[model samples]
Target: MTKTTFTGQRHPAASTEAENSVNKVPTETTMNQGGDSSHLSFQLTSHKLNGKNYLEWAQSVRLAIDGRGKLGHLTGETKKPEPGDPKMNAWRSENSMVIAWLLNSMEAAIGKPYLFLPTARDVWEAVRETYSDVENASQIFELKIKLWKVRQGERGVTIYYNEMVSLWQELDQCYNDEWECPKDSVKAMKKEENERVYLFLAGLNQEFDELRSRILGKNPLPTLRETFSEIRREETRRNVMLKLDSNLEGKNIDSSALVTAKNENDKKKKPWCDLCKKYWHTRETCWKIHGKPPNWKKKGADNRGSQAFQSSSEESGLQPSLEVPPFTKEQLELLHKLLQSQLQTSKLDPSTPTCSFSQTGQGLGEDDWQC
Candidate 1:
């Protein structure tokens, strides 16, 4: 009798076990390779990664994994195949891609030593062990101290809020996991949120004191997100009001300045007359008796005497009347009849001179009479 080694096709009783193994391995291989084509396209960058940013680095790595549809690999839900398994090549390819991306996404100083890691899980675990443990106690302490001392001086509301948010995030990644007991998961989260609200309020500028008090005065304190929103709105409103006020004040100042300048210009253009005690015309250009005659070119004692005489005559209403031309016929007849009637009634002769002016100043001399 010739004995042959067991082959699944020739030995019908062993066919079931062999067939099951064949089906399982190819299914695993197909699943892993199906998404590998897309995963190779997304590359990770080391933008914010430092030795101290393990949490941020880990978060970025997860996002990359999720983008590539490889979250199962990151969570360790998809483990490496055993030796000689048909799916082993596909499993190794998937894990190696993850590991490569992880190394590329880290700072060169922090990643160079870990570049030779055999799997993604190994690299991730090593980083966590280094940066997420007692080894980072000092760094965590520093971050906490900074958070405590942070202030909103000179910074805008959004900028200060963002900085505080960054501090809170880094602090959480450093100590939240280690200190928060697993038993108080939900309660611890709530407490941590409240603490964040208080910390944010405490670091705000004094200008925000009233708003901060309003938030704290609530029976149930507000969330950080809500607090930030309210503060941003208030800051915007304040800025708008200040700008409007400044613009209005600027317009008012400009108007007042223009009025003042016009008044000054008017004063400069007007000429004061000292002789007449009036404005708009100087003494040299005045037309009143107190002013020099415009046509009087010569200056001498005669001109001075004429000016004085003109001024005195004007003051005394003694200006000479116009010369009498030949009398009209009606005026001469009336005067002749008046003379004949006067000759008949009066005793004095017409040829004799008579004084018509009153003696108001001094006794008149014989030659001072006028007819």
Candidate 2:
């Protein structure tokens, strides 16, 4: 018998001839075949049990995928995407999974058409299904609720709920029925208290954040050793409190009201006024304080007169006379003469010529005068 070759390997002569003689074709193994060969045909719109309508299901997913990109190319024989597409950030559903799952949940619940926000269970499950790490995905839902509360404006919530049961009950009742929530009787008072607390907290947080940013923004954040010395230098007197040691306890004076004003004297560049202990530079620049010190006028420059500087500031819409450079004795004398001249000019009759003009005319005879 003559030998036959199969992919360069010799096969039994009789077996190879019988297989190759009739068909002249190659048969591929199950591993080499493409796709889910178990059930070759399928419809995307229908879930396994036909739980969803074909058109609507397809449209929803299409819309969702389209928001991020064209997911149409995903199909059999294709490799599964290794990671999420970055472009989907713009197409984010915000709470798409939550809303979709809610639609299904409500459809089953009331067993009819009903307008309902997604319940917590629906949101949780949807996120769980979408992301392998469910814990991280829950953050998106929380943020969605926050956005919803903000959009509701005056009806926004201030309380946090541990479970969905109470929250959903409130939301469902509010949406479905006419129910009035009791307004906090002490709201205005609470608002003022809250504002003070918030401001204090915010300022404290800002101080820490500024320090944190300065420290952490470097290529490598500072170590304890690098930061400790500077931190001590930055401390205020009260930072290391001079409390009567609680060990020798007496009355604990409330230090709550001990607030200090920032000294912005350098910003105003004004002279310090010991009397007011406020720095708008000096009493002369302290428009809000009113009733100046006896020598306030003596201290300020009379160069252009108060009104002249004040008018200039008004023209520029600036506060009157910002911290001006201090005048020496000679400069002060020159300023005095300058002010007197301005005042005299302001008071002069329109018909009269200036003193310089009148003097020049008197000194020069008509024969000596020329244009």
Candidate 3:
């Protein structure tokens, strides 16, 4: 009865079970520690919360934390374990990591007070109470004003669509209401979607007028996404057409400029007449050969003719001719008598040289003229 034995080693099954328990603890701890360490420098979003953007910042943080499977820490769904519990260390470690992430995602002044908070949920609630203004009518009015004014002016369709969607999402969050009946909810959702479609169409640039009309003409109006796709396609097509039109216009302008320059050069190269001192004609076709017209003075032809005559006389070393008055009948008879008397005197005195006129009746013959 006194032969009870106590051994340092346990049964094989017991030892294996104990070893498994020890391995499981370390494995779970390592996994949690690894997860926590990986996200040590993680920022939820590029936009830091500064009280004014609390709604948007909250949405971003929720999305990021949910992605990491740690949203429960912020929502209080993941409860704190008892002090001596095996999971207590991992829970505390993960909670602390989440708190760090939240702090990092906030503005320094806005996040400092939350640094000493006990848990992530406490920090989340504190921030919410301080900045969440979902029920504020002023906020709703401001959001409505922004939505009303959003337009596609100068921005690409995708950019405009993104901005509008962001505003819609924020506005929706502000007016989140749960319906009692599924049918009513569906109907309400459809109505809201239709209203959004109208808003989107209205905010488009006038360039999309035809497409917008086509979309509105449909019996059962297209969904917002479908309308957006159609509009996006149209935008791409318009861009291509505009580029082609600009290219064609540029080519036409270049061709017209070239033609104009060529015409100017051709005019510059035309023959000039010395007799008329005018462009586009030679001495053969000058007005002097054709005889001066009646409207020469009215048409400035007399001035041109005078300039040409003056230039030609200068070149030929001759004096310009002056206009002579018409002789009256008596004056002509007197001139003829004087000429006959002078001729008779010249004949009586053969020593005087006589002058002869040329066939043109305008100048003396070269042989009859003295130097």
Candidate 4:
């Protein structure tokens, strides 16, 4: 050895290489090298293996995987290689990623069993084997019975239709494709469609009878979705009409109450006088206008004469005379006694000659003045 080449520090080239390695950006493969890395920005659809909803759960999970572009991994289409194969590590890495996705998509309570499965395909197969069609006939029969009993009770057309749709989807999931021939499949599909239409029509509330008939009467019958939309619009129209009617009724009630209150107030505030044809005072208090005095007939001669005099005066624009009431018999007797006393005093005192009594034929008689 030509003297061992030793230095206090590493070569510049080695140092540069180390620096470059430290500064390198992670590639997609390296970022996902850990088999269970998740890159999704959202949570996946969750499924539960609660024994009764296996079909629905499986369908939902399958849809979830397909939506995320990882259906191939779950279906065994993108298969993982066996151990010791050249691409075994890569295969296992991808398979592990798929298995992690599936595990995340399961509900916590029922997901414990499938958590340790090696591959997504294995997990799917295990779940399917356990809950696929254990009681195919009975399950299908029960689903059919439920579909048959489905009704619109209390729910609006839209809600009822959505419920029916869920039942139909569940019924469809129960079908097995292995034993279905093209003829039987087509026939079954048509029959199911017919049943669906019938169920939808039958379940509708009576308010939608005419619409239901119209939908059924179409040349090529409308799909369940189209029918549902039509019924929703009808419901909206009914609601609007009901609101209008309610508003009208409220207005009417308010108007009637106001009228009644106004009438009552008018009655209380101003009583009517029928005799005067006026509203200020009642007939009882309007005696001056409507009633005659009880002694009017006894005082009629003076009253008539006074009325005639007033009429003449009013016609000629002269001053009116004062009116007087007729006197009673006792007053006349007192007047006669006073006049007799005056005569006796005149007799005693001769200074004043005795005045003679004279009757004026033109004037009113004394009897006329007496009551």
Compute each candidate's TM-score over C-alphas: 0.60, 0.13, 0.60, 0.58
Report how far off residue 98 is in candidate 2 (Å). Answer: 15
Cα lDDT of candidate 1 equals 0.65
Please report how far candidate 3 places residue 95 from its true position, in Å: 1.7
Q: Candidates sorted by lDDT, descending order?
A: 3, 1, 4, 2
Error of 1 at 117 (Å): 3.7
Give a tens-digit lDDT track for model 4, residues 144-249: 7887888887877766776666666555555544423566655655565665677788877888888888888886676556666788999999999999999999
Regarding TM-score, does 3 or 4 come out ahead? 3
Pairs with steric clashes in candidate 2? 270-281
Compare candidates 2 and 3 on lDDT and give the better one.
3
Please, what are the lDDT tens digits per residue for candidate 2 over residues 228-284?
334334334324454536423443333322221223434446566666686546765
**Candidate 4, after superposition: displacement of residue 28 in Å?**
14
User: lDDT tens string, model 1, 227-321?
Assistant: 88899999999899999999999999999999999999998789988887888988777778555665775533333333444555667777722
**Winner by lDDT:** 3
Whole-model lDDT values for every prediction: 0.65, 0.35, 0.73, 0.64
Candidate 3, pairs of clashing residues: none
